[model samples]
Target: MGFRVRSPQDFWGGIVLIIIALIAIWASRDLAGMRGFAFGPGTAPRLFAGLLAFCGALVALVGLLQDGPKIGAYAIRGPLFIVAAILTFALAVRPLGLVFATYVTFLVSIMASKEMRLIESVIAAAAMTAFCVGLFTYLLGLPFQLWPPFMY
Candidate 1:
């Protein structure tokens, strides 16, 4: 009997993850990892990449071995919203600053959920903004601007 993929989506997901992991490993290969006990920038990336690759392989193997449901229709809304949120954050962070950008990102991402409530989203946004400000600004002492230039 020919090999049948039990979960086409999971198998494909594994393949994509493996490909990404391979690319990461290749890109990080040239980065410095000095000899003997000296771990450089590449070390963590390589370790993570290796782990990702292994996990991807395991997922693929599981997909192959088990009988699973057929792949269903792909949903674009969640992914699109998440990408938009990330892009919004990247674009807004410099001009709008951390707190505003974080709030916007949280708000944008919340739209991806079908059961999203406005009040909950607002609360989440505020909490995320405060947490990010506390972590990056106060605890880590990062020099991120908290507000727009005009507000300063």
Candidate 2:
């Protein structure tokens, strides 16, 4: 079989997805599974994990067949800042509220890209923050504090 990886990113991404799915399956193994006519705690989780593995395999196969862009040099700044943004949002959401936390997170994550302009990023972040707040609080009907507790 003459197999060549056409999309290194997709190939590696699929491999990671498979590994994550395997880990999820392993972690849920101790939970109760199917018994007789009813589903158990682990049934849905294991089923989803199997589906994820299947999708990952499909992605890997596509990478092997289709031609795509070559892999570029890895950049730690992007991942690092993105993780930081996530952490910031998690830590600040309760204290700073949804509006502030979302904006801050967007700003932090935007810093990961070198080509992003400050003005454009700020505008985009504001728009995204408004959308998220509206979607979560109004559309989804979830109770999310929009502003700081002290503001009320």
Candidate 3:
């Protein structure tokens, strides 16, 4: 008898996770890991990536053992907007600063959701932007521009 995937969705999901984990691991490989007794910058990412790979394997194993629903068609809207938001943040963060970039990113990401409320999104985005500003600036002591250079 041919081996068949009992749970197509879980199997596919697990495969996707594994792919992501592998990408993460590959991405972090160049960074420093354990430096003798001290943990380096890449330690957490490498560890987490390994853990994710293990979890993905387990999920795929479960998929092989258990029955599941068939995989459905992929949605484009959410992923498209999410990618757009990431690109927006990356492009906007430098010239626009954190506040405007973050707010715009949030707004763009919210457009992907069907149940998004404009007022709530605005309020939430504002609060998150303020929190990030405070956290990165005051607590972390990282120098970040709150507004564009032209504005100041």
lDDT per residue for candidate 3 within 104-135, as digits (tens), equals: 99999999998999899999999988898889
Q: What is the C-alpha lDDT of each candidate?
A: 0.90, 0.92, 0.93
For model 1, give the 10-residue run with minimal summed lDDT: 65-74
- Compared with the true structure, the alpha-carbon lDDT of candidate 3 equals 0.93
Sort every candidate by lDDT, greatest first: 3, 2, 1
Q: What is the full ranking by TM-score, best candidate first?
A: 1, 3, 2
Cα RMSD to the true fold for all candidates: 5.8, 5.6, 6.7
The superposed Cα distance between candidate 1 and the true structure at residue 64, in angstroms, equals 15
- Candidate 3 ranges with C-alpha deviation above 4 Å: 1-71
User: Candidate 1: which stretches are off by over 4 Å?
Assistant: 1-71
Candidate 2 TM-score over all chains jointly: 0.54
All candidates' TM-scores?
0.56, 0.54, 0.55
Candidate 2 lDDT trough over 10 residues, lowest sum: 62-71
lDDT of 2: 0.92
Q: Which candidate ranks first by TM-score, i.e. highest?
A: 1
Pairs that collide in candidate 3 are none
